[model samples]
Target: MAWVYLFLGGVFEVGFTTCLRFTDGFRNIPWTIAFGICIVLSMVFLEVATRNSIPLGTGYAIWTGIGALGTVAIGMMFFGEAATFVRIFFVLGLVACIAGLKLTSGH
Candidate 1:
């Protein structure tokens, strides 16, 4: 399903972003390669999802929402990144926006 692909894309987006942090500004070959692969896979999945009837705007909004939340989760879990209350609330707001878009889009 397109939603499945979109979700995978989001997961990959988070993976690539976390890998980028480990890449140390591209000085680390392994992390760089991992980041590149994850990014490529994310785009590929996103393209697949776009082939379906989901509206471009709705799909993109949802994709970005999931990516944003997942990235923050990865940062907090693996990168020692801050998980302030305000940041968590903002991420939840993004999730709500994604749900609202999907519900209102009639898809």
Candidate 2:
């Protein structure tokens, strides 16, 4: 259950970041509101997840890992960002580390 919340928080972190990009430096009102909501909800979920079985360090690392990797993918696919091999390689490595942390956790 804590893992579930943690993963959800990570997912929302991507949404929050994407919405931030769409805000165009906060000039877009709707996207800015969405960004605020996403950030708030993501933090709430992270807090709850960390309060449960998962350690705060591991949970935060996973949350940030997902957010960074997902945002990069979304940027490449939708925002016309580059998809270089080195970037992809590092992203994969980050994912492996995140999975390892989850797998090796006491929880």
Candidate 3:
């Protein structure tokens, strides 16, 4: 379904973002390629997701919410980035917003 595509898109968004960090301004060849491929695939999935019944606002909000949370978690786990309480709270808020959008959108 469209929601599945949206979720996969979000996962690929996280993958590309993490690859961006590893690419180091595109100096790393493998990471750069990985990042580019992931980005392209993510966009493809997002486009497909948009073609279904879900409203643009709801789909995009959910996609971005998942992507943001996944990116931060990956950063913290793999890059030694801070996982502060405020950041966690903000991620929770993003989840709440996604839920609210889904409920109001009836999808």
Candidate number that wins on lDDT, 2 or 3: 2
Candidate 1, residues 12-77, lDDT tens digits: the string is 988898888899999999999999999999989888887776778787788788888998888888
The local distance difference test score of each candidate is 0.86, 0.92, 0.87
Which pairs clash (backbone N, Cα, C closer than 3 Å) in model 2? none
lDDT of 3 by residue, 10-104 (tens): 99999898899889889999999999999998888888988877888778888888889899888888888888999888878888987888789
2 versus 3: better TM-score goes to: 2
lDDT of 2 by residue, 8-58 (tens): 898899999999988999999999999999999899999999996899999
By lDDT rank, best first, the candidates go 2, 3, 1
Ten residues in a row with the worst lDDT in model 3? Answer: 50-59
Report clash pairs, candidate 1.
Answer: none
- Candidate 2: where is the Cα deviation over 4 Å? none
Select the stronger candidate by TM-score from 1 and 2: 2
lDDT of 1 at 12: 91
**How many clashes in each structure?**
0, 0, 0
